[model samples]
Target chain A: MKSLTKNDLTLLVAVAFLTLFAPFILNPFPEGSAMAQFNAGYPDLMQRFVIFGIFAIGFNILFGLTGYLSFGHAAFLGVGSYAAVWMFKLLSMNVIPAIILSVIVAGLFSLLIGFVSLRRSGIYFSILTLAFAQMMFALAYSVLTPITGGETGLQLALDDPRILGSSQTPEGNIPVPGLFGMEMRDSFDLELGSWVFTFNIGYYFCALVLIASFYLAIRIFRSPFGMMLRAVKSNQQRMNYTGLNTRPYTLAAFVISGMYAGLAGGLMASMDPLAGAERMQWTASGEVVLMTILGGAGTLIGPVLGAGFIKYFENIFSKINATILHEWFAFLPDGLEDFIVAILYPFIGKGWHLTLGILFMMVVIFLPGGLVEGGQRIRSWLQARKSKNGRPNGTTEPAE
Target chain B: MDAIILQILNGLDKGSAYALIALGLTLIFGTLGVVNFAHGALFMIGAFCAVTLSRILTLSHTVIDETKTDFLGNPLKVDVPYVHDIFGIAAGNAIIDWAVPLAILFAIPVMILVGVVMERGLIKHFYKRPHADQILVTFGLAIVLQEVIKYFYGANPIPTPAPAAFKGSFDFGAAIGFDPNLIIYPYWRIIYFLFATLIIGGVFAFLQFTTFGMVVRAGMADRETVGLLGINIDKRFTIMFGIAAAVAGLAGVMYTPINSPNYHMGMDFLVLSFVVVVVGGMGSLPGAVLAGFLLGVLESFASMREVIDIIPGINQIIIYLVAIIILLTRPRGLMGRKGVMED
Candidate 1:
């Protein structure tokens, strides 16, 4: 792969800045506007978007680079969350210690899980990971309820001593995660005409971290280790015959990805101050898989796009109701209006799952390479059409 | 000794479900090379068959009882169904009593039709896809089926009680020369165990003794070779899928009384059944049956208060823990054949 050009790096930095400011940009519309409904500017959901994006990116590192599809990756995320929450409870309200502890715990957990699960390859590996995940989920829900908080989940309380920060108030307010004296949620609002914008400190913090993660991922993708991982994906037997210990490399990648998940998990609890067992469910693990595949696995930017797309759709779809459907069909005739609304009824709110299911099926069937591939195909088609229209000579002239 | 026997009987009742579902899963995997993740959904559908049948059997119409007087001093009336009048009290009561048993007849064709439709519509297209793709599609199908059921059933566990004849516990100790209460087991549970044994035996016999069975085994071993011999292997595989569906349906039908069927019941059992399949070694028939019973007994042991206190949640994770240990020690699984998922 070519090294990142200066222009490309600049573009990336600019994009990162924009993402950090996305909440402000998105909040311009009135609260009641349709676009406002799609605003991912909220603290909780924005944190989730970046956190999940990070999670998927890490998953893509293992799966995309090494071609090892892990069905149990969510277990690491769950474990990380639990670890971070425990840190908050036992130590301090400061997120640094929580995040660091979470990453270390998650890394250790993955080392053990990956060591055993990686013994087999392909479907066996997938099944093994799945078994471990289910076991963890069950354990988390039942036996470890005291530690994991069972179905109710673990949360921070006022009783927790703030060794690094002020103790949370008795009103049960969420303590804004801070570094030094700078609080993450502190933001400034700007108004212009009918539009409003809010620039949040947490958004910048998340963006800075995301950019750092992306840069590290890019570096890894270009490194010798990445080449070795690709070699493992392409022909493991060939690599083994060439005198390489593939186990350590895979284990290293697993741990790195696991730490990323821990970071995401820590961020999740830092923003919300709560960690639920439901977050560790197999379904959550499956969701990350869907995001990776949907965005185009093996591409650096794809998982982020996929995460954003799914989160966006999830927000928009769930907010839709029968009233919205009725309004959408208002322009039609009396009989046709009701018919159209009825036909569209099951794809909204609680029925949004139906839409997601259909989208997943369509993507798998038509665009196995996912949204990135779809975009490339469309671009190439447009280019072909343009060239065909421009060519008038008997001999086709190629652009240099 | 009596406690041991009672626990053994309890284990068998649970074992019956695991065995039947594992049998179905192994059948499909053995023949189709496709993991039917929606097998649990089919089981849930079968349970609903009992619920639907009970609802149908008890349908009533009202008639006025003109001879009775109300608290307001007006003539009172009672409404009754025409079936009650025509069948008379004893026969009508018998019809209601036999609702669950009669549901088997209703479930078989319906379950088979569902199986056929699922195979022909969704799964047939996925036969050539990768295992991951197949898993994803089937997993999606399972979710969709479960959600649809939830939408209709309102997410509550609906009971499907067995007939009055099978309602009470049996004093097995009396026959075995022990205290009656010490060795007692539910009559319905024992019936379920027997029914599962018969179905398992029947399935095994059919596969072992018949020409169809011979062909299916041959196809499972090598489909191309079986096809070269002019056998329609795909048809056999499709039939095997149907058989698997029926087995899961039967398991659910019998399991309704033990644990009331809910929309999410299939999901709850799915992971455990997959563990059973894996422990038995993927696509191994006898291996599946053996592992199912072994895991079932182990789960019962883990559920004991003493064991649970020692290792909390062991009951929930016992099977999976065993599976991981087995896979690590033996990558091909306990009985997995060479070259299966080797690629």
Candidate 2:
């Protein structure tokens, strides 16, 4: 029995291996060293990487396959987070029930939204999704305060009744979210010589979910349903002329992608039992879009790569400040160093969004196919050079 | 009846803003055939133009006055505006007080340059690209412009008050023989309404009467054919983009007193304005203006205590709800041409 197509299987194994050893891989610098500031082995950032990777993967399935840009996709993720947090409050601290409920709730929510938004294609669909998301965000931030917790956000409280688990631990504190026996916050640090690799249960859990999400995405990409979605993207009118009802296919894809987003949201809340309406904001939606496009939207591994790239940069860029800038350029004369720091100040730390905005524009303007396409072009070019020396290159297919 | 009248007046004020922004958005879309997400940024820049002119007019230098002594028996140092030094104190003081109105003069040329550069440097390349690409690029541009504004002017809203002469509220109801002070409104808001009407009328008149406007209207109807007729329609569209920018900027400049200008204010208005544009009919100028006022009124009505008591959060979602309904029921929009963006 064949598992995956050779290239896909190779991709899956590589991803699995990378995720398993991520603590080591992400922590390249030695402890107490200047470069250690760049290390991202901590649980919070690592969980974010995989969680966002899952989001981008899900986003890619809809956008990359069908070319339908849902500008409000983050609404589903926000809904999923709210659901999961509510589950943690009402049912149990166990992430299992929360994850399942979040997925189901997100699926139903997306179904309702998709049914309405899918009426029109192109920019109308984008605007519809945007309006719905904005509407939800406003409601969640205001009148839905009883359910959504308003501006302060929904946080797990000490009084929350976890029917399956005790309301509070023996120490008289709120029970932390956990798998039946293991707490999400549990961490283990491994030291080898001067290097420190920190690992957390939450990060591993998220990584495992990401691997599964990635695998499922690959399966979907190789499926006939995905072909129909691609066909929808290329020519919906032609597909309609052929008597195909494209709505159901597109709707189904939208729902599935929404469920994937919900899954990511659930995982996020599981790691930290809180949810904010801000997650549903248009900027959050735009970030996922940027990730998918940056990584190469249509390519199978592209979204994951894009997700990692963005989250990692966001972390790194936000950590840089004037002091760090001055440290980096300390060799320059005082005037030059001050000038350079002033020039660079607005693109780092709290101003990282500006950098993101600029990068997003550049990517859309010059590299519409994303980083994956750029890589493919380079590889093909290298092969062409080899073919000049009499070794022919394999014909390449555009990322799908 | 008084309460209802008050809400309607509020709605008209809100509608004036919505109409102005949506007018510019529709103008750009109608002429260039590009969905510009950065058009709101132009509106935002216009408000900042007012802020900037105020800042510039008040540029001052320290002068030691011999007549006025400090507690230390030293001559008092006075900060005197450069404008006062240039054109005696009274004239400079007058110019500074009227900075917001003067910004209209400054913003027109600046906004036109911005619009032309955006059209030529960025939006021109996107004419042939997919709508999604156009949206994405322009959205990115919007963020960049917003961030650039935030960097220079901090994140807080800058209060650019209307001139002192128009500072107080005007009781218009008494003039109309209603109970005194029953329908009082700000002098500035009344000015804004008249100003919006003037701008809207100017745009319509420009489009209706001028050779340039005629060429643009013809281009919008059939670009290839217009080109075939040997008119440089692209150049006119670029100028149309400039005019649209000026309109949005002027609206922004006038709007600063009504709602203090902030960097993100453009985005806040942009989403609703897009809804207004869509509901008005995608490419129809009249549709956009009609839809803008209609939605504004509807939104105001929804926010009324009576309406909110029944629908809870209806006001929050009313514009979007209306837009969704209109989009579904009338895909061609209230004033949309049949073939334009139907697919």
- The model with the greatest TM-score is 2
**Candidate 1 residue runs with Cα over 4 Å from true position:** A5-18, A24-29, A166-176, A392-400, B59-93
Expressed as tens digits, the lDDT of each residue in B1-343 for candidate 1 is: 6766666777888878888898998898888888888998999988888888878777777666678888987876665645577899788788878877788888888888888888888888888987777877777788778777776776789988888899888899998899667778889998898888898999999999999999999898889999998878888788878888988898888788888889888977887888888888888888888888888888787888878889878988888889999987876677778877664
Clashing pairs in 2: B280-B287
**What do the candidate models score in CA lDDT, each in turn?**
0.81, 0.92
Tens digits of lDDT, candidate 2, B1-53: 87687788788888998999999999988888789888888899999999999
Candidate 2 lDDT by residue in tens digits, A1-400: 1768999989999999989999999999999998888998888999999999999999999999999999899999999999999999999999999999999999999999999999998888998999999999999999999999999999988898888888889999988889988999999889999998888999999999999989999989899999999999999999999998999999999999999999999999999999999999987998899999989988988898889889998998899999999999999999999999999999998888899889889989998988888898999998888876774445666889
Q: Chain A TM-score per model, please list them.
A: 0.91, 0.95
* Native contacts retained by candidate 2: 0.72
Which CAPRI quality tier does the interface of model 2 achieve? medium
Question: Where is the poorest 10-residue window by lDDT in model 1 chain A?
Answer: A169-178
Q: Candidates' DockQ values?
A: 0.54, 0.80
Lowest summed lDDT across 10 adjacent residues in model 1 chain B is found at: B75-84
What's the lDDT for residue A252 in model 1? 85
